[model samples]
Target: MSKDQTRRRILEAAGPVFAEKGYDAATVREICSRAGVNLAAVNYYFGSKEQLYVETLQYGRDPEGQHDQPLTWPADAAPEDKLRLFIEGLVRQMLGERAPWHRQLMLREILQPTGACRQLVERHFRARMDQLLGILDEILPPEVPLSRRQQIAFSIVGQALYYRVASEIVKFLVDEDQRQAHFGVDQLAAHILDFSLAALGLHPGLAVPRPEVTHEPLEP
Candidate 1:
């Protein structure tokens, strides 16, 4: 196999292994075996097992080769639209071309988090929290604690993605129709968008409603 193919094979193999075994418990030998590649190839492509593991769990951009289209975040797009894109992009990236393993691998990392897990939290994920802090500040009153935004961010991401990660429990809790409907990413995104709109204290989707001007009646 070509060098690029070998590297990708290793990534795909190592993700599940890390997911299943946790980071420290996982071994390079198992990943190499899963990829059906030579030991030297892993070293050549990634330098070390630790490095390979980190790359596997990072907020990876999907490997689209030349055909990967960039998200067109129009200047006028609502913040909620951008948020949905971020959430959906994350979901798609994990699923890659293999949707079935997406939950298995993701749930493993979430439930049994490893030290390398912080690499993601420190990088894109933490930064995402910061952005939400800024967004929520715009909607909530100035008197609200600075910590509230960060907490809200955690709840939003945790609520939406964890539902997908822990789908078996969700399936058990909900009726068949709601479960089937939310199984698709667009439908999932819609549910999340509605929650986010409420969190932001606004109407949702293609239109953001005008605020009603309510005046209190004068004392009679």
Candidate 2:
């Protein structure tokens, strides 16, 4: 294989290995064996196993290095539209539209951070978090504190992640028919958007109306 092809192959192979075993447990020999490349190729191309792990993460997150696509929107787009897009992108990523290993590796990092974890956050997640916070700033009232805004941002992301983190539980809780109907990317995104907007007092019409309760005295 050509140099670029060889490197790409290693990265592709490394992503799943590192994702499954994490940085410490994963080995270069296994990665090279999986890639069908010589063991020396990893050291030559990525310099070290740690560096290879970092690059594998980058490849898994965005193989093309297309950083601008997800957060990009028309300048004149409404905050609500931006928020919808953000939630959709997040839900899609969590649902493995990007790739299953991408989410799996990220979840592993969050749960058990390593030396490369900071780099992952700084390179990939910080920009996304900033974008989400900016959207929340537009939607939430000015009086809302930054701390509270941060909480709201985490809440929004948590709702999307719940479907992925508890996928089996979700399957057990939601029948296949209901899952097929309402748990799709678009449906879940729309639900989260409407739910968030209503909570922020921005889209009261989208909120589900609560059933009226009657209080009647019972005769003895």
Candidate 3:
């Protein structure tokens, strides 16, 4: 295989392994086996298992190659539009099926951080947080304290993440037939956008369906 192809294969294989077993429990031999490459390939490319694990985390963070795309919208896009886009992106990153390890690895880090945690935060988490905070600054009044703005940004992120982190509970609480309709990523994103806008005292301009009238008597 070409040098770049080999590196990509190793990274793709390593992501799920690290996510499944974490850095300490995951083995370089297993990653090599999964990638169909010799053990020396890892050492040659990344120099160490720890370095490989960090690159895997970085790959998981941007599996869709979003970094290659324009990182932000046009300068004239409304703040609300940017906020909606941010929320939707978060929902997709957290729950999208195309790269399950992205969420799994993040959860693993949260439960038990390792040497890789610092690099992951510096490379991915902090940058994303700063972007969200910048968007929040535009939406919130200038008089609002930075601390309050940070809290609001966290609030929006927390609301979106709850659906991902507590998804099993959400599935249990939701009716089986309604699960996909209600809890799908796009649906969750819309709900979060509407809910957040409402909380901010801004209308999302999406119509809300009124409750259906029923002639059935109430249960005792």
Q: Which candidate's TM-score is highest?
A: 2
- Worst lDDT run of 10 residues, candidate 1, spans 59-68
Model 1 stretches with alpha carbons more than 4 Å out: 1-12, 19-21, 24-27, 38-52, 55-72, 83-110, 175-178, 204-220
Comparing 1 with 3 on TM-score, the higher-scoring candidate is 3
User: lDDT of candidate 2?
Assistant: 0.83
| 111-140 per-residue lDDT for model 2 (tens digits) | 677767587656666778899999887777
- The C-alpha lDDT values of all candidates are 0.65, 0.83, 0.81
Model 1: per-residue Cα lDDT over 76-99, one tens digit each: 667766677766765554433464
Clashing pairs in 2: none
Off by over 4 Å in 2: 1-5, 24-29, 40-48, 59-68, 97-104, 205-220
Q: Write candidate 3's Cα lDDT for 64-84 as tens digits.
A: 666533257777899889988
**TM-score of each predicted structure versus truth:** 0.61, 0.79, 0.77
Candidate numbers, best lDDT first, in rank order: 2, 3, 1
Model 2, C-alpha of 2: deviation from truth (Å): 4.7
